[model samples]
Target chain A: MGESLRIYAKLVGAQGRAQASYRTSFWLDLIGSSIIVGADLIAVLVIFSRVPALGGFSISQTLVFFGIALTAFSIADLVVGNIERMRNYVRMGTLDAMLIRPLGVLPQLLANDVGFRRAGRVVYAGAVYVVALSYADIDWTPGRVVLVVSAPLFGAVFFAAFFVATATVAIWWVESGELANALTYGGRDLTSYPISIYGGWFRRMFAFGLGFAFVAYYPGLALLGDPDPLGGPAWLGWASPLVGIAASGVAALIWRTGVRHYRSTGS
Target chain B: MGLVTATTDRVTIRNFAEFASLIGAIAASGFRRFWTYRQATVAALATNTMFGFLRTYVMLAMAALTPVVAGYTGPQLAAYVWTGQGLLGVVMLWGYADLADRIRSGDVVTDLLRPIHPVLNYLAVDLGRAAHGMIFRFLPPVAVGVIVFDMYLPQDLSTYPLFAISVLLAVIVCFACRYLVNASAFWLLDHRGVVMVWLFVSGLFGGLYFPIRFLPQWAALLIWLGTPGPSMLQAPMDIFVERDPFRVQLAIVGVQVFWAVLMLWACHVVQRRAERKMVIQGG
Candidate 1:
C-alpha cells in the first residue's frame, strides 16, 4: 500500500508540475476557477438580501450549509473529477493502455490529470466556512466540534463516490457526461441550501433516495443544534461518516462492474 | 430620368435578393450542423431542465418569505427562472470559441476571403443555432415549468411579438459580444484568459445565476446603461413575464436595440483592425 501510494504521488506530481510550468496561464485558471465559487456565494447572498432566513435558517446558518457543500464538492472535484473523462478514454481506446498497467485502474485514472486549478475553490470555500462558523451561533461540545471538523471530510468522500459511480455509467454510454452532471453538480447545488426549501418528490429523491442530505443538510443541523424541519431523526445528522463509507462501497462495486464490462471502441 | 432611376432600383433589388439568399443558406447549414449532435442536445436539455427545477425552488422559497421581492412575485419569479433557463441556450452567453480557434490556427483568413462580411456570415449561423435551440432546448423546460408550477403568462396579445423582437435583438447583441472576445485572439494568439473573463462577467452580469433586478437599483441601472450583459437575457425574460409596465418594457427593448447596434458596430471595427494586423501563427 505504501509503494502504491508513492507511485501514485509521483505520477500526479509530474502532471501537477507540468501544469504549473505555465505560471501565467496556471494562475489565470486558478483565479478564474475561484470566481465560480464567488458567483455561487453571491447568488446565496442575493437570495438572503430580501429575506432574513431561508427555509427557517438564518443567513449565517445557511452560509454554513453553503460552505460545507462548496468545500466538500470542491475537494471531490479537485481529486477525482477528471474521472468523468472516462468517456473520452473509452472512446479513444486509452482504457486499454491503462488496463495493462500494474497500478489499479481507478488510481491511475485519478492521477491521470489532477486538476490543481480547483485548489482555488477549496481555499475560497474553506475561508468562507471559517467566516461562517465565526458568525453562526453554535453550542460547541466535543462531539459538535468533531463533527464540525469532520463533516466536510465525510461530505467530500460522499461526493467523490458520486463522481466515480456516475462516471462509471460512461463505460456503457459515452454521451452521458451532462446527464451525470445533472446528478453530481445537481447534488452539490441541492445541498448548498436547506433541503426543506424543496418539496414533493424532488426533495425525497435527491435528499434521501440519493443520500445527498447527509452531505451538508444534516451536518448543518448538527452544527446549528436544530432539529430537521421535515421531522427526520436528530441522529441522522451524525450519520455522514457512515453514509460516506456506504457510498464508497457502492461506488467501488459499480466501478469494478463497469471496468469488467467495458468493451473498447476497437478503433 | 425615369428609365435610369428604374434600372438602378432593379440593380439594388437584385443585390439585396442575393444577400438574403446567402444568409438563408448559411443559417440553414448552421441549423442542420447543430441538429446532427443529437445526443449532446438531449443531454444539455436534461441538464438545463434539472437546473430549472433547482432555481425555481429557490425563487419560490424567497417569494414565500414576502409577497414580492425585487418587484417579482412568486409566479413572476417562476416565469423568469424557467424562461431564463430556456433562453440560456438560445442566447448562449458563453462557450462559443470557434472564432478564437480559427483565429489561433490562422484559418480565419478564409473567412475574410468570402464575399460576405464575416460578421454577417457568423451572425446568420448563430441565428440558425438560436432557432434550433428555440425549438429543441427552449421549449422543454418551459413546458415542464408550465406543467409543474403556476407560472406567469402574459395576458396581452402584443407581448408575444414584442418578446420575439426582444429575444432576436438579444441574440444579436450576445453574438457581437462573443465575437469581440474571440477576435482578441488575432492579437494575443491565445485568448483563453479573455474567454474566461467573458464567461465570468457574462454569467454574473448577464443575469444567468439570478436576476439583475435582484441587485441594488443603482447597480442594476448601471449595468442596464453601461453594459450589454443584462440586455442579453434579463430584458427578454422581463418582457416575456411582463414584469415591467408597457412603457418600461418598450424602454427595455429600446435599450437592447441600442446595445445590439453598438456591439455590432464594435465587432465591425475590431474585425477591420484584426484584418490589418493579420498575424498568422504556425505557418
Candidate 2:
C-alpha cells in the first residue's frame, strides 16, 4: 500500500509540474476557477436577496450548505474529475496503452491531469465554509466539531464516487458524458440548496435514494441543530461517511465491471 | 479616383446578392453539421430538462414563501426557469471556442483569405446552430415544463413575433460576444483565460443562473444598459413570460437590437485590428 501511494504521488507530482510549467496560464486558470466559485456564491446571494429564506433555511445556513457542496464538488473535481475524459481515452486508444502499463487504469487516469487550478475552488470554497460556519449559530459540541471536519471529507468521497461511477458508463456508452454531467454537476446544484425546496419523487430520488442529501442538507441541519423540515431521521447527518463508503463500494464495482467489458477501439 | 470609386461601388452592389446566398449556405451547413450529432442532442436535452426541474422547483419554493418576489409570480418564475433552460442552448451561454482553436492552429489564415468576413461567417454559422437548437434543445425542456408546472404563457398575440425577434437578436449578440472572446486568441495565443472569464461573466450576468431583475433595480438597470448580458438571455425570457407591460416588452426587444448591432460592430473592429497585427504562432 505504501509503495502504491508513493507511485501515485509521483505520477500526480509529474502532472502538477507539467501544468505549473505554463505559469501564466496556470495562474489564469486558478483565478478563473475561483471566479466560477464566486459565480455560484453570487447566485445564492441573488436568490436570498429576493427571499429571506429558501425552503426554511436562512441565507447563512444555505451558505453553509452551498459551501459544503462546493468544497466537496471542487475537491472531487480537482482529484478524479478527469475520469470523465474516459470517452476521449477510449476514442483515442489511450486506454489500450494504459492496459499495457503496470499501473492501475483508474490511478493513472486520476493522475493524468491533476488540475491544480481547481485547487483555487477548494481554497475559495473553504473560505466560504469557514465564514458561513462562524455565522451559522451552531451549538458547540464534540460530535458537531467532528461532523464539521468530516462533512466535507465524506462529501468529497461521495462526489468522487459519483464521478467515477458515472464516468464508468463511458465504457459501454461512449456518448454518455453529458448524461454523467447531469448527475455529478447536476447533483452538486441540487444539494447546494435546502432539499426541502424540491418536492415529490424528484426530491426523494436524489436526496434519499441517491444519497445527495447526506452530502450537505442533513449535515447542515445537524450543525444548525434544526430538525429536518422534511422530517428525516435525526441520525442522517452523521450518516455521510457511511454513505460515502457505500457509494465508493458501488463505484468501485461499476468501474471494475466496466474495465472488464471495455473493448478498446481498434486502431 | 472617380473610375476606381465607380468600380468599387458597382462591385459592392453586385456582391450583395451573392453575399446573402453565401451566408445562407454557411448557416445551412452549420445547421446540418449540428444535426448529425443526434445522440449529443438527446443527451444535452436530458441534461437541460433535469436542470430545468431543479431550477423550477427552487423558483417555486421561493414564490411559495411570497406570492411574488421581484415582480415575478410563481408561474412567471417557472416560465423564466423553463424558457431559460430552453434558451440556454439557443443562445449558447458558453462552451464555444472553435474560433480560438483555429486561431491557435494558424488555420484562421484561411478564414481571413476567404472573401467573406470572418465575423459574418461565424455569425451565420451560429445562427444556424441556434436554429437547430431552437428545434431540438429548446423544445424538450420547455415541453416538459408546460406539462409538469404552471408555466406562464404570454397572452398577447403580438408577443410571439416580439419574442422571436428578441431571441434572434439574442443569438446575434451572444455570437458577437463569443466571437470577441475567441478573437483574443490572436493576441493571447492561448485564449483559455479569456474563455474562462467569459464563462463566469456570461453565467452570472447573462442571467443564466437567475433573473437579473431579482437584483436591486439600479443594479439590474446597470447590467441591462451597460452590458450585453441581459440582451443574451434575460430580455427574451422576460418578454416570453410577460414580466413587464407591452411597451416595456417592446423596449426590451429594442435594447436587444441595440446590443446586437453594437456587438457585431465591435466584432468587426476587433477582427480588423487582429488581422493587421496577425502573427502566426508556430510558423
Candidate 3:
C-alpha cells in the first residue's frame, strides 16, 4: 500500500508538471470553466426571479443544494481526473506500464493524471458555496455544519464511481468513451439545478435504487429541513452520502470485472 | 441546383435494389463499428438519466409555485427537460474536434483524396452514431420520462410523421452548424476554444439547458433570428411537444435547409481558400 501510494504521488506530480508547461492554455481553460459555473448560476438566479419558491424550497435553500453539489463535483473532478482520462491511457497502450509496476493497477490509474485546470472549478464552487451559505438559514449547529461541509466527500465518491464505471468501458471500446463524457460532464452541469425539475423516471431512478439522489437532493433536504418531494420519510435525506459511497464501491467492482473482460478479450 | 442533383442521384440509387443493398451493407458495417462501444452507451444513458432528474426537479419546483409556468404544466416541463437531455445525445456533434484533428494531423490531405466523398462518409458515421445514441442514449430517458411523469404524447397521430421529419431536419441543421465551425480548423491550429464558446452560446440560445421560451422576449427573438441553435433543439421540442405541427415542421426544415445550403456553400469557398493558403504556406 505504501509503495503504491508513493508511486501514485510521483505519477500525479509528473502530471502536474506536464500540465503546468501549458500555462496559457491552463489559464484559458480555467477562465472558461469558471464561466461555465457562472453561467449555470446565472440561469438558476433567473429561474428564481420568476418563481417565488421551488417545491417549497426558497432560492437560498436551492443555492445550498447547488453549493453542495458543485463543491462535491469539483472535489470529485480533482481526484478522479486521472481515472477519467483512462481512455487516453488505454488507447495509447500506457496501461501496460502500470500493469508492470509493483503497485496495484487501480492506484496507478487513479494517480496518473492531475488536472490543475480544474482548480479553477474548485475555487468557483467554493466561492459560490460560501456566498450561498452566507445568505442561507443554515443553522449554526456544529453537527449541521459538519454534515453540510462533508457532503462533497461522499459526493466525490459517487461521481468518481460514475467516472470509473465509464472508464472501465475503455477496456471494451476505447474510442466511445465520449458517451461517458457526455454523461459525467453533462450530469455535473445538470446537478447544479434543483433535481425536481427533471423528468419523472429519471428522478425516481436516481433517487431510489440507482442511488444518485443521495448526491445532492436527499442531503439538501436534510440540511435544509425540507420535506421529501417524493413523499418518503425524512431520514432518507441524511443517508444520501451512503449512496455515493455505495456507487463508488459498485463502480470499483465493475472496474475489476471490466479489467478481467479486457484481459480475456485482448481489447 | 446542387440539391436537385443530389436528390436525383439519391432517387436513382433508391430505385435500384443492388445499389440500395450496397448502401445498406456499408451502413451496417458503420453501425457495427459504433455498437461495439456498448459500455459507452450504458454510461451515457446513466448520465443522461441523472441530468434528466435534476432538470425535472427544477421544473417541478417551479410548477409548485404555479400550476403552469410558461405554456407547460409540471408534467409537460418534465417531458421537455427529459426530451431536451435525450436530444443532446442524439443531435449534438463533435464535428469540430474531429475536423481539427484531421487538419492538424495533415490527414485532411488523405481525406480530400479519397475516392468517396469525405462529407458523405462523415455524414454516414454521424448518422450511425446518432442511431446508436437515439437507441442507447435517447430512448432510455424518453422511456423513463413516460413512466415517471406520465408525460403526454403527440395528440395527433398524423403529426408523428412531421415530428420525424422535423427531427431529421434538426439533426441536419445541427450537423451543418458543427461542420461549418469545424471547417475553421483548416486555417486555425486549435478550434477548441472557439468551439467551447460556441457550445456555451448554444446552451443559452439553442435551448439545450433551458428552452428559449424562458428567455426574455427580445433575447429569445434575437436567438431565433441570429443563431441556428433554436432550430436545432428548441424548435423541434416545441413542435413535438406543443403539437404545433405546421409551424414547428416548417421552422425546423426551413432553417435546416437554409443552413445546409449556407454551410455547403461556405465549405466550398473555405476549402478553396484553404487549399490556396496551404499551397502558399507549404502545408
Better of 2 and 3 by TM-score: 2
Clash numbers, per candidate: 0, 0, 12
Ranking the candidates on lDDT from highest down gives 1, 2, 3
Where does candidate 1 chain A have its weakest 10-residue lDDT segment?
Answer: A174-183
lDDT of 3 by residue, B102-193 (tens): 77887776555443445655655666666666677677899988977657677777557876666666676776677667778876666656
Q: Which consecutive 10 residues in model 3 chain B have the weakest lDDT in total?
A: B1-10
TM-score of chain A of 2: 0.97
* Model 2: per-residue Cα lDDT over B64-125, one tens digit each: 89999899999999999999999999998878888988988877766764657778889999
Q: How do all models score by TM-score?
A: 0.95, 0.96, 0.80
Candidate 3 chain A minimal-lDDT segment of 10 residues? A258-267
User: In model 3, where do residues sit more than 4 Å from their true spots?
Assistant: A1-7, A87-93, A169-205, A208-214, A217-267, B1-50, B94-96, B114-144, B243-256
Residue-level lDDT of model 1, residues B224-243, one tens digit each, is 89999999988999999888
Question: Per-residue lDDT tens digits of candidate 1, residues A129-221?
Answer: 999988997889999989997999999999999999989988888876477788788888999999999979998888898899999999999
Which model is ahead, 1 or 2, in terms of DockQ? 2
> What is each candidate's DockQ, to 2 decimals?
0.64, 0.78, 0.32
